[model samples]
Target chain A: MHMIQSVGIIGCGALGRNLFHNLKPLEGLTVECFCRSIEKDDSLYQSSVRKIEELFHCDLILIAVSDQDIIEVGQILNAYSGIVAHCSGATPLHNFNGKGGVFYPLQSFSRSVIRSFKEIPLFIEGDNEETTIQLYSFAQRLSNQVEQLSSEKRQKLHLAAVVSQNFSNHLIALTQAYLEKEGISFQALIPLLEEGLGNALYQNAREIQSGPARRKDTKTLDAHLSLLKEEKRLLPLYEQLSESIKTYYEEDF
Target chain B: MHMIQSVGIIGCGALGRNLFHNLKPLEGLTVECFCRSIEKDDSLYQSSVRKIEELFHCDLILIAVSDQDIIEVGQILNAYSGIVAHCSGATPLHNFNGKGGVFYPLQSFSRSVIRSFKEIPLFIEGDNEETTIQLYSFAQRLSNQVEQLSSEKRQKLHLAAVVSQNFSNHLIALTQAYLEKEGISFQALIPLLEEGLGNALYQNAREIQSGPARRKDTKTLDAHLSLLKEEKRLLPLYEQLSESIKTYYEEDF
Candidate 1:
């Protein structure tokens, strides 16, 4: 696999914008960002070209549009014979028309958050070995953690990621909301939350598990449930998650 | 309220051991640990006094036993007239005898993990103003983030801590298990996990939430459920948590 000379990014959303910014500075990598908006003093990569055909001059085209629009972008690039990929974790490789590949970064990005691509784990899957190697080489330039995964396995990884990120964040949100109702500030819980994450990273979660649910402290559990009774939406989640924790620990006990 | 001259810790578990180590280094604070084990030329503050009455010598007695043993420790300390506090977050102030107070650190501690008390949110509550001020001054020596919280509010905070720590760690465990089965390393997901925690700390979780669940993508959800069918324990948690996310976002849509 050789160094990628040029790369084209479609869409200017968080993923695309970050991708463009990350790839733009890499040596021997010329990035062209295609978007609807254009400025007179736009960067060298920013292009107002709406025609997908005109922007197919790059060695690779990275689709960073919405999930629904990914297939359409692939279809529009069907005429091009160059390597094509989408930055979607959940989407399958078959969505692309030609030289299909997935260059999904297992990360949650926002316009405001200045995230470095150095440690972001990238999952690349392609229609064939050649495409996979090409995308892997391209991804390696942007991130140190790059691996080749099958579409099936990548989908599973994506699902696991949803649990690790979205579901975990939801639990934190529940914590914040519960404390807010009690006139306690959210900042107070940050240390506990950070320590919890640190423990999860370094230790086995099973051994490190604590709380009323894991301890089977019915009194504390009942007190929490009573406190959450008024929170109709949270009550069910609290019960379900706590019940799961209890069930998991009870097996060992 | 001016300063704590001497302190007694009642347990030798993770919290008690760590507290003794942290407090022993502070100026003007002499920590006497009351544990079962006694050693010759033991470190400063390692007092293996089997007699509970000997703990009454300190200005304050901090009970650091397990939740079940807290009441018994408090009962033993019923004869003492000095300020008494339990380090248990879930246990209320009423559980203690004499001048009761709470000196709860909002951080998780493990035997193997070396954690500093600095910046750890210290939630303190006493039966009365005098006890509260005395404990506050003592807590100030150990940490900068100290606050006075009512028992009712601290119990709610404990519940919130359980969600943020236990439930979230369970999700990370789930991630590790899933990835390991696929021959993927846990280290691969650390960046994403760290980023997710950073997001929850700084941004609004609801606004930053992402995934097929947030998008209500039924196709991906079905695929994930099928993949998780073999995981009897994790499947239900996956379904319930995803459903909760779906429900939360659906209301807005």
Candidate 2:
């Protein structure tokens, strides 16, 4: 890898913009950002995000667009002679030309919040050994934890991330709505949740799994099912989730 | 309500044992433990847990038994002349004659962990005003957060708790198992989960809901489904959960 000095970031969504600002502090690195329209805050990226053609010759070009746009963006950056990577878990390394790679950050980014990139896990992959090392070194500069993950392994990781982070968060949100509808304070459950999650983390989630479904307490489960009779929307979800729990614990592996 | 000087706790399960140990420190209160058989650790409860006859005459007998056993224990204490509260979210207040009440703690307890009982929310319910106040004041001594919740409301609270804490914890367990199967360190996902959860709590889970399903990104969603195909048990769960997420956000009310 030639002594990489300049980096180009595409898109100004949550991740793209954040990477542009976060990478600016690296020693002797000139960061440039490209987007269709340059917003006021996006000026942090080399004064303003210009055009994609301006980024073609940079030492490294990272496409921070959505999964659907990754292939198109990669094609647009096809002329680039440097390493071209798309920060996507779903998109593969072969989406771009010979030098294409991946620089995916596992954490979900918010457009408004400028967060420290140090703790986020960045998964890197490249077309070849040289590109792999180049991409790994670049990702290591942004996040302390960087792994050389393949397209298949990275997809599995993304699926796990979706179920654990996104699904659990949605479940909490449903509970929040339930409590609010019942005229109960959602704050009442926060202490209990914190303690439960703490115990799960400490003792391991498998060892400490409990509740009516885990216990196979038919009476309690039936009572809950009846309680959700009016909540037709949540009824099927509750059933599906309960069935999954039972299948996991009760069935033979 | 008479100044309850004596308290009797029945059963030696996780919540029961924990409550018995925690309530021992209340100033000027005599606490007795009554279980079928006393184990070595049961010595902390008035030297040892004895027969149910000994707990019958106590000023306040808290039946810390399972939901199914609450009625039996309440009947055994029916000969008493004071508040007989069953510390159950599932069992109602009408189980223990006119003196029947509820002293349910909202947090799950482990038998081995002697956790500080300060922050756990205790929901109190009684058949009458006198019993309600008696249980409320008694519970206030045990935990800082005490509320007079009706049986219906407490049932609703318990349902919310089941879905939020228990279900979400199980999701993480599944994710852990998946990551382990792939020979990936579960530690990699922790940082992302913590950061994502923090943002969800701060901004709101509903506002921060992002994932293939939520975005209606069929390509990524299909990729995840196929990835989970090798995991036969998890494939249905993946589909159902994704469907629920789509229903919650994508569909019109």
Candidate 3:
């Protein structure tokens, strides 16, 4: 038997809840969530504990709290001899002192939807070589794709993630806002959204960039800018991004 | 039998090539592309005609050129009495002076990849009721999702498309650049990207937003801001967008 049979979660936010939900069904693994307030209904898991000492008995304690609470949680778990890990993309593993590692699933998690982890990549980082291998093995159980990423690399990945996920999502929100303003349903843009994402998956995005900006069709671009007369704040972003696209295409082509 | 048995596209660019490639293999439709330059071994149907009158025999003509040339193309097509259209999301159908309509496929297109129009929505606008129905019926033959949108609505849809497609793509490119600079493959972020997008498909995007800004994790956000030390230009964009996300989540929540 391994040392890490039972897993304890430090927080119960979106990531923590998802981990609890997913880990509870796995065979040979018992899941426990450590929250400030213990809920009466323990149907989702084996148990919910209020004290850290109660969770200290578990062999693996995964900290899924906010980044602000990572150091505090780490200090609390200092006495425990089990493997400790967190699910943050930006924070380094060293923040968690002894036998610490990371179980960062490189995907967005929400309490409402359960994402399949079959092919999703999980990036693992550890304090030492042994801990790295252990966490890598554990992550492999949940996902086929696993990698050992350094703190530096993980930070960069997080930056990229913010751009792709957060920024892209903001763009979608902007699109929704624009359509809503004209009494048009946002559903009209779904096909374009799927195709844009699909194109990025199959081909190099730099090669496939289009629109008036890429082609440097100033006439159409100017027309578009003119249409956004009321949206004065977005005008600068439009011009700057268009200029960037034009420069990128020019440099490449 | 109907007068239009074949569709001819002018300007074999991304839009033109995609239309030709997709419309060619249909059971009853034969497709041809008019190229400005002559190539020796073009596999698909090609035409090198300088005059629109040379290709006047075809009943359906699709001009997929830049917006600047749209009016010129419309004038050229005014001589013929067949159904003429442009595949532009932004250009209004009235620009064609009642002689043409818009067959705007509301999806991103590329020359290298094969895209299925079956699920992609086509937003059609026309000068008359007959043309609108004809365009809708034609689009239905290729895709199941077809909607009649007014010029104003289509423009709004186009703006949303810019946010969903162009701006979203730019975000992905920025992410790729960030990861590549740190010697990390952007491929690691693909799973995350897929999950984020997939979640938005089933759930409201406003509900599932996460990250440092949404969580109000000042530590993580500060750390991310610090990482942009060298690239000062992106700082404002980062800050503005983060604020936007924070504002959105607060308002929605």
Question: What TM-score fits each model?
Answer: 0.92, 0.96, 0.88
Each prediction's total of clashing residue pairs, residues at least 3 apart in sequence or on different chains, is: 0, 0, 0
CA lDDT of every candidate: 0.81, 0.81, 0.75
lDDT of 1 by residue, B1-253 (tens): 4456888888877898788889877887777878766566655334557677887878888888888888877888877878889987888896355588999998877765557888899999998888899999889888989999998888888888877888898888778877888876777777888877887877788777888888888888888898889998788888988888888776742
Instruction: Quote the lDDT for A3 in model 3.
Output: 40
Positional deviation of residue A188's Cα in model 3 after best superposition, in angstroms = 2.6
lDDT of 2 by residue, B1-253 (tens): 3878888888878877788778887898988877777656455544445678777668888777788877766677656777788877876677466677888888887777877778888999888888888888888888899999999999989998898888888888888888888988778788777766655554567767889899999999888887887887678778887888888886563
Candidate 3 i-RMS: 1.9
Candidates sorted by TM-score, best first:
2, 1, 3
Q: Which window of ten consecutive residues has the lowest lDDT sum in model 3 chain B? A: B43-52
Candidate 2: docking tier: medium
Docking class of 1: medium
Candidate 2: where is the Cα deviation over 4 Å? Answer: A40-45, A201-203, B40-46, B201-203, B251-253
Return model 1's CA RMSD, one decimal: 2.6
Best by DockQ: 1
